[model samples]
Target: MIKKPPFVVLSKISDQIARLETEVAVASPTLANVYNDLQCQIDVVVANLEPLQTISGHIEIVERSMETILDFLSSSGDKSISAANVYSLLEPLHAKIHQQGEQLRKIV
Candidate 1:
């Protein structure tokens, strides 16, 4: 059986929550109370899902920085770029990539 991706699952769950919220507005007092409790549970699920989204974004940034660094190194040919010069050129990108990786690790 094929499983749905987490974001897709979360989106569907969010849609159902929205529908339930609408129902809550017109529900009886008892039903509305039940819906409110369910809403709190759903809120927790959504909160957990947020970290997954944040990690995905951070991974994209790390990938982009890695590509940029690769491109920079690949294009360095006859240029007598010293080690210090190369390090200086790549340090910011390296720092950004490392920061994103650290953020992802924390999220995980």
Candidate 2:
């Protein structure tokens, strides 16, 4: 199966984040060399964000896979494992995504 390109979209996001960071710094602070600092921080943040987005995508795939497995388990004549375990694994992932989303919202 053909899968979507993950990093390509992320690269665009990184560029946007970098541009915003630079713009924010240049527009604010009103200090000498503030642009340099803004660029640095933007680079740091974009670097951080790219990986987080990748992780988020992976988590989504995992959740879907888990759901599929649960479906298969239910369909067959077997009930060895409970779906709760899959949900339990997803709890932390869900929380992390929510937290990151909040952080991103604050940026926008």
Candidate 3:
């Protein structure tokens, strides 16, 4: 068995390193473009989510207002309560409004 000198082994290793470097360098631009595309997609996703978040917040505010109104009406005793029930009249409306608002929010 023959052992190679240290300098010869080092030279071979350097050649292999150079070849690898060249391969990576050649592919670098394509890799960079792919990275940029992924970044753009992420940006688009984040940008799209903003409007939905805003709409959800707005819907929450409206729901809270409706709840407050319902509470206020319940607290205030009505003289003509026998004719029409407040909960029956308003509960459906609040549910409908909340449902529609939620749908709209999702569309955003």
Against the true structure, whose TM-score is highest?
1
TM-score of 1: 0.58
For all predictions, the C-alpha RMSD in Å is 4.0, 8.6, 18.8
Among these predictions, the greatest lDDT belongs to 1
lDDT of 1: 0.74
lDDT of 3 by residue, 1-108 (tens): 789744455445555545555565577967655555554555555556555556666667767877876687777776456435667656666786677577676765
lDDT minimum window of 10 residues, candidate 2: 29-38
Pairwise lDDT winner, candidates 2 and 3: 2
Per-residue accuracy of model 1 over 4-47 as CA lDDT, tens digit each: 87767766776786687677778676776776677677777777
Q: Where is model 3 poorest over a 10-residue stretch in terms of lDDT?
A: 5-14
How accurate locally, in lDDT, is each candidate? Answer: 0.74, 0.63, 0.62
- State the lDDT at 14 in candidate 1: 64
> Residue 96 in candidate 3 has what lDDT?
64
Count of residue pairs whose backbone atoms collide, per candidate: 0, 0, 0
